[model samples]
Target chain A: MSRMILLTEGMSNPEEAKTATGLLRYRGEEVAAVFDSACIGETAQDVFGVGGAIPFVDSLDGLEADTLVMGIATAGGELPGAWRDIIADALRSGMKILNGLHTFISDDPEFASLAAEHGGELIDVRRPPAGLVVSSNEARNTPCFRVHTVGHDCGVGKMLTALELTTAVRGRGHTAEFLATGQTGIMITGSGIPIDAVVSDFVAGAAEQLVLENRDKEFLFIEGQGSLVHPLYSGVTLSLLHGCAPQAMVMGYDPTRTTIRHSAKPMPPIAEVIGLYEAMANVMAPSRVVAVAANTASLQESAARELLVSLGESLGLPATDVVRFGCEPIVDAVLEERRRVGEGAED
Target chain B: MSRMILLTEGMSNPEEAKTATGLLRYRGEEVAAVFDSACIGETAQDVFGVGGAIPFVDSLDGLEADTLVMGIATAGGELPGAWRDIIADALRSGMKILNGLHTFISDDPEFASLAAEHGGELIDVRRPPAGLVVSSNEARNTPCFRVHTVGHDCGVGKMLTALELTTAVRGRGHTAEFLATGQTGIMITGSGIPIDAVVSDFVAGAAEQLVLENRDKEFLFIEGQGSLVHPLYSGVTLSLLHGCAPQAMVMGYDPTRTTIRHSAKPMPPIAEVIGLYEAMANVMAPSRVVAVAANTASLQESAARELLVSLGESLGLPATDVVRFGCEPIVDAVLEERRRVGEGAED
Candidate 1:
């Protein structure tokens, strides 16, 4: 197995260093250390309260790793200019780079030449495959029960919820596959179409291709991208919704976020947001939000549990913070929805 | 103005030769002839019943033109391989090529080398500008009365409706600017963002940029893209819808068709479609579809007028073929909607 060092640098916050946290949480066995100058000498447990005993190193001077993973998600996925020297050093030392940013490292002349000279490989996980046609809604013809995890906004745990739900579903002895739509999710899952990196006209096609590719799976927990109300990304959100043609949906929301971050638009009531999602999905097929994955990270355990109970009662659906409480409740709701819709029924 | 020859080739039919027809209809002064071997001796009038008597030629050998325009809008914007030799010939002879396809002509190695070798320029109208960030709802601050032309399906006269409405509004002594969202519109108007060619994350940003750039115009008729019900391109539709954040919308539909052309989904009732558009728009701000621009190309004069009248009455909005009748009814309804909503009202 290749030893990996995650490069998060200035992004130590869990939300900012999502890619780093995700790999540490799910693929911990492969991660040797994290490279964050500010969090040097600290462990992942000290910084994120998880990834037990994984040490943080300031530089490659003493680290033993063959692969470097980009561990921060930038706003527009542009590579930070400050990291050039470190990345060049890594490439010069023959360490492969796994990049999830929109900026393809393989396409950069300097990086390409350095990697070619050093026998180092550059894998751009966000580079979408070519010749993707428009979606023909072929996913609808598949026999799999698709459960898409939509969100109230970007970075609200949609991917995490989907991953957890996939685990829960598979634990129940059902074959479930997690479909990744974003960079972090793609890295965790090993393969996925970077929906946001695709051309605007083929966003749905990419989502549909993911579903069709895993048609043999009994259940598909599709990781959704932006919110329906998100000012900039609603198009991606809607495209994924229609392309996946989910039989059921899990609404992911960060309760602490009252409005979409970085935009002037205020978040509508959760019930209303659910309605909007259902309405958009119904335009393609009959789909409903069967549960809610509440991100109650800001609250204490007791408060989070209490809020989940009341929220579930109000919305008349199962609600839980998959991190605090296991994904059983949400998975149970999805199973119930599948049964109600007649498991793998074609409409 | 440079003398131009439209390269429609085998796409002699008006629908297939939309770029050729659009240029001939709107910018006839620059067009010298059309290069469609299939319709060698025919004129634009014989082929499209419009554009006076611009003759079609079998080849570019004797054509006196300084520029060649790719005149077919292929599915997925791909350039037909059969047309490569002719395009190369045009480039070799030092003629500028105006391309609207998703395939950027200048990016092709051979075409790029040829254009560089010869004194010829290649303009890819669909190539999006760089550095587009997520939208922050900056367009809502613009004081212009934005009229967005939405559609029931792709190729349903959305762009033409916006162009016609702009002319009608200008004829009424109002300073109206047409915002192009597609290649044909970009070719016709000389400048506008190609919304679909952009990255999925920045579709709305591109739309927002167009509105903010043209904010000084008193009236803005923003051309729409694919339908909200269109399986392949709905994301582009929604992004354009939310990006423009129009005060009023004109519903463009082809009454002769009852379903989204290439998909299995049937078209919903026009009223419901309008409601969907309004509800999606209202998520950002108050907006409504005030009129209908019916495409009655398949129907005869009286039958088309009869359908338009009934369609308008049934939907309770001003409807016209725009091509057959004129944009007066739709423009009047838009003016009424603006008055009711309080012109240039900042909500």
Candidate 2:
């Protein structure tokens, strides 16, 4: 049997970690104890509830374990000195250790050195592929698109988006699948991981799934959470397109929460957002980039036009190549035209 | 100027949309009106604030827009009949509409038919690929691995994990990059998109980026978010592995939450949380799946071993295939061993 200590700078999201514990057990692992420097008053049992791992207040009580897994700290970086000492003490005790910090691996050097010296290894898990071979076998004749929806906790907009996208793409003479990825309520409350990473990873994962599942489809559609405000969400999508070389990629354009005032900036500028879209189009070199401002009023026509133009220019596409459809009539007209094209090609 | 109705089911997290509106304005889009159905007693001005786009109740009185973009609904399903009436009225009035309700399109066959009859197309935006891809020209002699960290909103556990993974992988004769993903906040109170999507997508995206940017790498390493009960999160990652098909995948095994509570009477046995992981491993079939579960204590050894064996069997792999390590020392050892192997191969 192995035992380990999880040292953290502050109170961790015990709920999520608790969930992870169940997963670990399902995979055949045990958690001995969790020690948090920030959570002083509460016992680990109290914090995590029954069947939860125990909590340790002090690091030096001759706690023995075959291994120790470190809890992640906040954005400011590393646990306080006391916590570091505990980690060092654990290392000296001949306990094996694993660190699960992804960003800090690249951003901090001191911690990196310490990890090396302590005979502990820090593993960053999000590195890219050795190689990717994308074939259109799965996507042939399928209407491929991505849908993004926004919502708060428990809201079903994201799910709705998945359902809708699947229906629409299927309707368009193609097969569609719902690839689910996005932030959960815990993440938004600031407990588990960063928003940017959430968006990026989801987008990429969705794309990869689409490419693998619908290899012969002519288009790729993505659906995402609407409320998050990370540039990387859209950026990562573009990067995927470049790698997989999808014939075309479509993204839902809904910016609902950007208007609010918050400590952290709400959303990126529309131009910036559009810029990312354009950048993706450029990288993927799609045949045409379509901008469907769905249900946006004529009042927003100017803004939509500007975004379309910018997107076109960034992609070095002509205005004709960047199609803008607004209102039901326009949306219908575009779809009709597409249907007609499909029909004509069949003829 | 175009007039559009922005219908929100309830309180919308107006973070990203607001910023995007400013950006839209910079890009020259006029936002006409925003209708929030949830603001029962609040005045339109109070809810919408003073801006180009005024907020109103869900009424279609003398409103006109070329397009309509539906915001996230606090309610999980289709808009109420009254709300739907307003939207239908707008559509009847010839206003173009764009909505994020991907589910509504299918949930309501009438709406789907109407879109088809009216020539409106429901578009789904597809996300780009996950992970980083570097060109062969940019390849370096050193190998690189990706690190992922998990934390609370303010915690930097992910950052640290990233840092540590990078250090260890690089030390093992490979270069390392760090990526972050996942949400960091309180447990969101609803059922919607799984939260793990955020982290999984980010990891995938980061990996895609690396691969596209540097094409010479032969493998991708992903560090996953450490959680316990939510199979959805872990499931999302497992799904992503199938989609991404990385050379190897490494994950931490800290089970505090993955267990199914057995009840005497008949509700379905709470599905094992690790079932998702097992399913994902089977589907992805990565070359290597290294799981570090060196955290359980002696008292819990039996349970831990049972869980591990079950997990291994589910994935159709041997128990020995899952690597068990103590936290610091084990991580160090793994990194060192990997590095030596890489160096040996290079030599």
Candidate 3:
């Protein structure tokens, strides 16, 4: 059994971690131990279900593991002293370290040096495949993708918009999945766990599950929060993509509003959404592309077109190669249709 | 006993909410009900003693209370249809709705209209006092004026910075009290909860106890989470402040960081910290000021000086009027000196 230790700065979400653990267990990888900065004593024991020590020594004991999974902090922040020590120990033990949060260590000379010395890689999951080709038939066959939706009470529109885009992708034969990041009935504060933590755990969990299920798929969709002000969704999406290193193309949607709320108001300006996509596209550089504009005014469509053109030009792909779909009943309707098809196939 | 219903958004920290509840209880007000949007039935029952139901009722039907206190969401984004209905209903009831997250409502006009039509006032707690003045003696006496020492673990710097400032204000013979906005120790998605939540809760909790025990002062110090990256903190803070309206002054701090982890290395640039303080000072316009710099680095001191100068210039106060103190060793030194003074006085 291959052993893997997951080191997370205490700033992550627990539910995501549980999902990751479940995914790892399903993947047939022995998760040796999980270390969090905040879990200590009885709570740590209860949570980790192992020796209830403050600094759980699983990562430090030079345990034989094929991979040391390190949760990425959102920005350019240094690891806790304890984390630094554990990473140093893991490096000394010749362990292969995989870091999900790239921006955090990108500027740090010491971390970069350590990565070089230990043959560790800082992955940027947000980036799309290089020189990847997507056939229209392939798009039609596997027209959907999966994403985790996160937001406050009324911010469901963020997810709804992503679902709409998923439908359009499937219209070309691709599928999309919408995974709820936080559970229902949890207060915003209670559920107010950071999005990066949720994304990290979800990506890891999803990857593990996918590997276990032996589901050959390409492309993972991520839906950001409606409010542009909060960077959790973006940050986490980047980190998750980095950690998972998925083979398929990865994509994300930016809502129209700077602030995402669950309400009846129209979505944000198309320009803003397009700008977000452009920025993310520049950062990630996905190979094949599909974008759907939902609940958007006609004016927004022009902006979306311009954005797709710019993205295609930058990626050296023709503008027509990037599929752009309308918002009218594309996501919800197509998803329903796919369900019906699946049901019919089952029958 | 007057009945008060406090309605808050879900993402609030439970410990902070409990502290606020204690403060309200000390004020001779009976909390009839408390509602948090993120809270599940079980947790809500545990925190507010309300079983599996939304805490606030917009209509006064079957409710006997002259004074009804409800926390309103001020953060602008879309609200759920149900949430809008709740807010609209609450306003129509002619109840005194306290705007907890003042920042959210101040930025949006629709909320202002709702408050106006519903007979509620959009209270701006960050607004400058009618006649703001800071005496050196008062600065020396108030908890807000005092120096504070805290650790990096659990967002101690931000939490204590806010708490110490609030405490300094109270020490100046003002009727000061501190109220925390949310709870602590919730796990969703990621690795685990960060230490900052715990530290903030502890500091706020301690401050609340002190304020309740000494209520003869004229000013109140309401401590809330400084980090607004999470909406729940903003929501809960807004609601709590609304409940304690007509407060003489509301004190908070502005700390800058690049990452979400509690223990990130490489503190924010001095310029960024200065920018944050300048922005916050413009927003807060505190009357008297004592700026304490953590003895983390010389650059931090320089940043504090820059912040003080900018703040004083904006407020038309002398730069020297903004007294600067080093937080390291102050708490321990103060306690030791106080013990010696008491012993000598007794002898």
Which candidate ranks first by lDDT, i.e. highest?
1
lDDT of 1 by residue, A1-347 (tens): 87999998888887678888889888899999998889977899999877899999878876789999999876667788888998999999999999998788998999999999999999999999888878887887788999999988888889999999898898999999999999999999788899998999888988999999999999999999888888788898999999999989999988888777667778888999999999889888899999999988789999998999999999999898899888898988998888989744762
Which is the better candidate, 1 or 2, if ranked by TM-score? 1
| TM-score of every candidate | 0.94, 0.27, 0.30
The Cα RMSD across the true interface for model 3 is: 17.2
lDDT of 1 by residue, B47-135 (tens): 97767789988778877899999998866778888899999999999999999998889889999999999989999999998788777
- The lDDT for every candidate, in the order shown, is 0.88, 0.37, 0.35
Q: Say which prediction, candidate 1 or candidate 2, comes out ahead on lDDT.
A: 1
Winner by TM-score:
1
lDDT (Cα, tens digit) per residue for candidate 2, span B247-281? 33333433432331111111111123233233223
Ranking by TM-score: 1, 3, 2
A36-85: candidate 3 lDDT, tens digit per residue: 65653333345533323323334356555665666432222234566667
Kindly provide the TM-score of model 2 when superposed on the true structure, using C-alpha atoms.
0.27
**What is the Å distance of residue A42 in model 2 from its true position?**
3.1
**What fnat does each of the candidate structures reach?**
0.75, 0.09, 0.00
User: Please, what are the lDDT tens digits per residue for candidate 3 over residues B1-347?
Assistant: 44566655553443234323332323323555554545434343455433333353334556654333333322221223454555555556655543333133345576567767877654332221221111111121233222121111123233334345445644544444333322211100111112111211122222333334334444343333322222112212211222222112222223343442222223434333333223222211222222322322223677866765674456433222111453322333333333444353321
Q: After superposition, how far is residue A60 of candidate 3 from its true place, in Å?
A: 61
